[model samples]
Target chain A: MLFRIIKRTDLTGTQAVMFRTAAVFLALLTSSVFIIILGNNPFEVYASMLEGSFGSVYGIKETIIKTIPLVITSLGIAVAFKMKFWNIGAEGQIFMGAFAASYFALNHADIPRPALLVIMAAAGFLVGGLWALIPAIFKAQFGTNETLFTLMMNYIALKWVTYLQYGPWKDPGANGFPKIANFHDNAILPKVFGVHIGWIIAIVLIVIMYVFIHHTKRGFEISVIGESENTARYAGMNVKKIIITSILISGGICGLTGMIQASAVNNTLAVEVTGGVGYMAIITTWLAQLSAPVILLVSFLFAVLVQGGAYIQTAFQIPQSVASIIQGMILFFVLGSEFFIQYKLILNKSILKKEAKGGI
Target chain B: MDFALLFAYAVHAGTPLLFATLGEMVTEKSGNLNLGVEGMMLMGAVMGFQVGIATSNPLLAVVGAAAAGALGGLIFAFLTVTLRANQVVSGLALTIFGTGFAGFFGQKLTGKIVPGPITTFFGEAKVPLLSDIPFVGKILFAQNLFVYFGYVAAIALGVYLFHTRKGLNLRAVGENPAAADASGINISLYKYTHILLGGALCGLGGAYLSLVYVPTWKENITAGRGWIAVALVIFTTWSPYRAIIGSYLFGCLDIIGFRIQDLKIKVSPYIIDMLPYIVTIVVLVFISMRKSKENAPPKGLGNPYFREDR
Candidate 1:
């Protein structure tokens, strides 16, 4: 049968939500094929995944820890993406931020606890913002392709951290093992009820970002620039300044994630500080459609997938990559479902009749 | 350090990159910025290695790799071309999927060796007269069949992209799809064909790594070479011929750290590892500063086209 695709201009909110939900269901159903191939029952494997992620208090805590970075970094990415700036260097920014925070933590352990924590946060924010600023300046001044430029920066940042881990920052007490020294008590972030203060910080930022993006004048300028740089300029916006400012905020927030992860989770900075969270945040940020509230929901769901994926690796003797495979499938199905939301396919009756008559 | 051997090894190391850059260049020339080269290469590497082990045939392995890569390309094309999804996000999703797919299957193949016959089949053979030349001969003429194919592919792609009528039509589509559509060019056909062709070449590049470079299966065997290839496409300004130089230069950068260590130079290996990425950023800045129109990306690049929207 012949088919024609037509754009749908009248999609309702409920319909869009239904499409996404169906896409997610389809992703799980398809990934079950792989689970079956691995000689496991699909339902049991999926049940194990759910049990693993939310089954126990520890499992729940680990999921939240993963969610913390995902949420913070996604929020940061949303800012630059709102201006169509494609800042793909969150990985690099996170590393630089962790490095900067670690430097002060290691050298000045004598500072008071609250004061040291504040300084580390400031250091991460500044260093991460500056690391991102290099590309922003090049982009504004020369119109360089930010996508590839930011990507290159990720490696550079990674190598820098690697250098520090094996060279200067190598703990002298570890008997030649290449690892950074653990943070002093003053350098660590205190826990709230059960988790690190990062969760509290995450919620606060969500509120601030919601207000900044939808209610503020600068945020309105950002949307205008995203729509069309020419239109923003016509409306007397300083386009270059806005781009630089938004990226600084974006990169700074990512840097804060690095500091939190290092001080709270790892208790020491290393090359694995970001652990692919930087790249994954891009996905969550996009899936969230650049909305603060939606980012929280999406990141939480993604964390469940990650935590469950990790759990299945041991429980079922399955490889850790099954989780990655499932995540990829979900992304693909969700991405494809967007097309259905925006357009509809119709059967072409005339073409079908012609084909039935065997006419060329 | 032996300079001659370094150059030879640089050319050997660069062969896979040349293939990937050429593939991505073709895809981008059709106005689709697929950022899934790393994932596609991994898929090719794993599939090629598996087929090589199964059939003990080098040719079949390569074909398998290319087919696997094309499958990856097909997924990307369906999303970005037919579904009109955001190109950047869709490409990232493809990369994630490809990485997982390769990792899952490749886990069993770890430490397995390629069959003896396939290894011998890919072994180096020197060109008689060409191998006799002092510096250039050793670097270019004396290499395995896979490396030789890289040279041919580079020249062939250059001719196809710049000199052929079909190539011109493809470029027109990338530069201005609405105009190309108005002129009766099949924009979707050109995009799908080029994108698939691009994916196949990327697969070959991945196969080169597993079947030729290392001759074994390893998770993430591409080791960000796919990403380096993506950067090289921009570094070479979408020209296949320039890709040869860019790939080898990066290849030299890749091995220079090892060469330095052999010479007892005190430089940190990590610092040396950072050179290629740093150079790409610097070169990108310089290229953008020049503001050369010819060096810019396609006008319609990264935007989904709908004849009705126009």
Candidate 2:
């Protein structure tokens, strides 16, 4: 072999940052080749993306609105991932949460706005948390594969939502088109400043999550469990309880995101309500390494990509799938970069000896 | 419903899944839990569809799809095997990438005239004497070449995994990479080879969808079959023969939905669509509940190997 990889003891903070930046730069550079193949300038494409997401006040608002769900979902996902629980069912949780909120809104249309919002929030959070807990409980009790379990739940939830839109919950006034009924005025989250209150909630949650993960004993226990179950057990940590609670929090938060998104953004439950954010949040949380502030920033960037990707669809005739491709590349490069951070490539032993002997 | 007809329909619907599940089974046997089969299959679907349309050759399309899927596997290998990234995350990234790649190309290919020759090529091939046999003939012999390919692949894999020396080594690698390494097996070599081969199979599965199953280019044409294949691997308890059975069963469940809808049943189509997923969860729960040691997953699964640490 020309080169051998040697595992490093650790990477410094600055070195880690450099590796991430390099990965991002390389991912963009690689994606540029695809742009050129399509007869487009990568720089122009990127500039338009930036402009589309941040150019006008409307663009900014849309970006912020997009960021709200992403930040909340990713932050919620971060909780489960912190314990290495692998809760990939955030999509389902979000849907269930939205469904619960919608159910509340539909039946309680006559209720006061403020009270209805509270009930919807509670309903959404509880439903989402319960949905998430199913997999967590199974994993805790039976040691079942949660990743597959959670993933299966997502399709089930999606199908359930689709059924609702087409069947019992279909809006009677949509003239036979399969559309879920719009939420009552009381169900909608009121806008604060410009965007809905989801942004404020997300910000507050971020701070709470940061404090919970870093400064709390429970967070410390989660880190230990993530490192090793045996070690956590030896330390007298109730690993099962922690795992269940963490996933509940993760799922619950994702569900709350659904409620906010449904009430504030879409104003109706649809099969596409989650908009792939659940899957996107999985990557974002992983990319952020479960850091709350980093998650917020990463999600913001993701929002820009999504908003801008849609923008470029009409502005430049580029398919929105281009954004997915770019996002995948970024994630791939970043994932690959972790290898470089943990292990450095070096010349193979024979080559190293030969080079050293030949050197003056 | 005619039992034999439903069985035949199940076989036809199950071919793609059988390929994917077998592919994933092989990959998992190398201790790498790849969850990107969906993406790889989609990539294969688009590429094979394009090639089939261009050349009008089913054989060429299968080859093309396999190659496309292998390309996906190659990326996954570099990330998980060489770079030692998280297998799950890398697999997810591969799916996202593959899906995007397929969708982009698929969008361009749609509404364009390339003359689909593979459609004619995939016409049913009823074995002359075999077709005359009883119900078994209709259920097994009367099918497209792809269906036979799936059967042969499954049986071949079953034999290979249980009967061959190399197969034993591959299993050993998955079960205990460190032990395999100590016993002079090149763990990385087996991991990469099997992962890539598995990827190719997944790609073929995807190709089967575009070139054989649906016979058209459309966005997300594979639907959730890739994920279903992943679940089927578990349902089969990692056995190729079991995978064949599990795939057909799931396939029947899927087709039954449409069959019921055609019969004017009052059931919502979406509810019927949920059967496979719900069944998967139920199977997963049951399998775990059994807690049988022999049915357990590979011990070294999902963990990166660091030789120096050991």
Candidate 3:
């Protein structure tokens, strides 16, 4: 496991920074609770998050590779999320990529590298985008709840992939289970300089996206739509178009991560295709304030937390679910902390206690 | 498969969704969309099993699940209402918290059956002579007490939402909190009360699963029923009666497909399992076709209401 970096966002002022600090402190306290539950020191569990992610060469490399997909997928969601679109089904979109890669690997096992890679990547992106389009179109046009819509999209995507892996798309030669075919040597991503090439692509995409978000008209329009649909509409922005396009791109990248996992890392698909990266990406992007560059750091931090979770489990015999718990706590603190960053708390003890006593 | 058998299982499958959707409808009517229904249901499943095991009473155990579910909602309310946090984030947090909380706590509670009500309640639900009726009576009327309550809740909630004065205020709050506030409605209290009450109902739905439907406590027992209920809120246009229809449709769709699998039909179980979610997305497409201002969510569904948004 890797000790990944979590992006530290600038809160813009010193005195106002107390909320973010308190959030981290609360997260620390929450992790300590797990430490107590695991029969270990709370400080140790946190140190373990750092130590496990960056403690060894292999761990660091793993963290780097894991962050690649996270960065890419999170960036995808970040594009929409920054505009407050809340595309929570990136995991399912990632599955689309994995499913596509698996399909390509099975169908064209003898294809050449460039041709296969291009087709597989495009297919993954398109499928992811299409998967996202279903919900986005509905959300943009049907008044359906996007959160629920995207969530349902996730299950559908998982089951769709499951159907294939278990049925006609199921690996014919392998025993029962939802296993996809192996990506052949040509289809598999070639590691350059001993690091996964997919990571390189992710890095490139980050720079490009950073430019796109800051320098482009579409990005500005996204912010407008997010701020208010009425305003965006008044400004002549095609709000639905933006929602659809953004979600589709987001889904496409999620698909790219799936393809990377299927071809570069796992070389096959499983239920863990997205590996909870979809939700993790949400937290990462949120941490980075939806800034493209910040995603890199935030992704790394989460990678460590996830990878270290296993170590803590082994060391203390704690259920690996502890990692998820810590994750939840972090998100809780991060989200709660933002309240402080945005709004200062007033200690009107008399009013609060009075309200409390009045049975409100 | 015999129509009677298919019908029976459909009723069974729909029970949890029935309970959850009704709960969400009530909450939404009161102007709060409690996205924590999934969390509430999950806690309900675990708590119901644990409590039922200790007390050896199915009804009492169900009450425990309801209470636990209410607690889950209460936490969400504390955050979103009193604490005035983001509703969407708070709801999502509740789900994450509940998921992890259940996973950690459920390690022991899972796999153990409660002492009572495995088959007794399901077995005892048949009417004296009504059981002899053809497809209509068997499919519609006969079931456990929970199923009957689901139907009653649907009708009763429908009336309470549309007929009553309080229901009008609730609708007023959901549509525009500012308007409701201007009208002197106590916004936070109604939101908290309905959200918690909705949670209790969701918990009961979850309890129905362990105590009556599945007759066992299974990990992930709610199994996206919460998600289904979340969608039902949209599908029903936030209406209690429509929610009932939507939930039952999903429930029936869920069972009919699965029954084919149990009968060892040639279709892929994976594909069959995908039916409900896939269909929901497809329906979402149809719904999205009209997703303009006329039929959209209340303007303030997800935004946290602040007395100071001005």
Candidate 4:
């Protein structure tokens, strides 16, 4: 018997949802094998994972804290991906954003709190946008591979931050071991409830992004260009300008994420400011298929996994890296499941009959 | 300047990269751009170290490393080739999987060094007569077995890729899979074969670090060498021979960062360390700027081929 995969004419929304759900289920099912091998009950492990993320107010807050960066960065990535531009430099972009914001806050410590925050945000937005612009311009003009370019940019940005923390920006008063200087009271972001205002910004941005992508003329241009650059040109859209603008916005939002991480959360510039959220955002954003609402949900799920993963480290003696393994398995399953969503496997009836006759 | 010493160090540093770059090059030539080289290398490093520690056999370590690396590659091929998924996403997932998987197991080997016999097994095997030549001999002929293996592998693969019938077919598969398929080539089989082999080579490179070069287990020991290897494939314009030279040049650049730091220069060493990646971007731009067909990446690179798809 032989089977061949045939492409489907169209995949409905329901089927996509079903496939995605199945992928998640299958991922968990496969993950159970690892859990069992580790001598932990799969059910108890999963229960603990949930409890670790949402068991207490602090756990919930931590999950939200993680989600803020993941959501904001993924949103920024969505804009670029929507335009078919692979902006993988969100890590670098986030660092630049954090660096710029910290620089502003450090130099303008005398400024009023509100004005200082605004300036820091602007600095972050502009710097992050500029960092992203380098590759976008190169990509638009020379057709350079942005994926590798962005990847390289990440290490450069990381090294730059490392240089700062260890060299000029090191807090001298702390003495030895190296550390970035903390923001002054006025420079720090104020909290509304228990958590900082980063999540508030993220929520507001989500609404704006939804409106921007669905209702705005520029958003229409982005979708058109993403679908086909030639088609966009034929429609009289300024392709280069659109590409530049989209990535700038994408990068600007990523910068905002960095700014929040620095001013609100870390309260200082450090190499760990981005905290691998930039890379994680890539997976979440891609997994969400660039949908704003879906990104929020996916980001929340990822944040839970991260927060819970950390919990498992202390709670169950599981290594923190296990989270990455679980996430990777989930991504692999979903990525593979996409094939089934797009195509159908068909058994060859004629081949089966021929096989049966030959056997007889 | 001690040119011979630098050359020897450069050869030592670049061998692992050469293994990885050659593997990535072969995989890329098969039209699947697998970006999980870093992950594969890390897994190879950890797995190879663990096995070497257990068996006290360098040969077994080498095989173990290759097998672990091939497993990483197999995961990639299964997702991208068999399932017709997005190559970039799948590659990234494979990377995440490999890095974490390696890291999770690698904690046990913290601060552990390779077994003594394993090191001696991979130790320098100075060529019989070639070692007698004054300066050039030490730089070229005097090296560990893995270094020699790199040379043999590079030359052999270089010749095979350009001169052999199967190599031509593989090139054809990369350049134009649909056309190759029409001409009776098994596109999927070629892709899976090369990608798996490429991954295994990357694993071997990782193993080299643990077993020969550093010979100690350190977290993220590959530390962007795998990435540099990826860039080297592009920098060398996808020729295995050029990969050898490219890896050495990059290896020299990498070693120079530490060498200069030892000299106590005022400049931050990290800035100097940024040379390879920055140069990679510049080389990529330069390569793109030339806009020649010969210098171009394989036409079908990063695209999944379905026989029915027009």
Better of 2 and 4 by DockQ: 2
DockQ (Cα-based) for each candidate: 0.76, 0.74, 0.41, 0.70
lDDT of each: 0.92, 0.89, 0.76, 0.89
lDDT of 2: 0.89
Chain B: TM-scores of all predictions: 0.97, 0.94, 0.89, 0.96
Segments in model 2 whose C-alpha atoms lie over 4 Å from true places: A349-351, A354-360, B112-117, B261-266
Which has the better lDDT: candidate 1, or candidate 2? Answer: 1
Instruction: Report the TM-score for the A-chain of model 2.
Output: 0.95
Model 1 B-chain TM: 0.97
Candidate 4, residues A241-288, lDDT tens digits: the string is: 999988989999999899999998899999889998988898899889
Candidate structures ordered by DockQ, highest first: 1, 2, 4, 3
lDDT of 2 by residue, A86-124 (tens): 888999999999999999888888999999999999999
- TM-score, candidate number 4: 0.96
Encode model 1's per-residue lDDT on A69-182: one tens digit a residue: 999999999999999998999999999999999988999999999999999999999999988889999999988888888989999999999999998789999999999999
For residue B251, give model 1's deviation from the true position in Å. 1.1
lDDT of 1 at B132: 90
**lDDT, candidate 4, residue A304?**
92
lDDT at position B115, candidate 3: 72
Candidate 1: regions farther than 4 A off: A348-360
The better-scoring model by lDDT among 1 and 4 is: 1
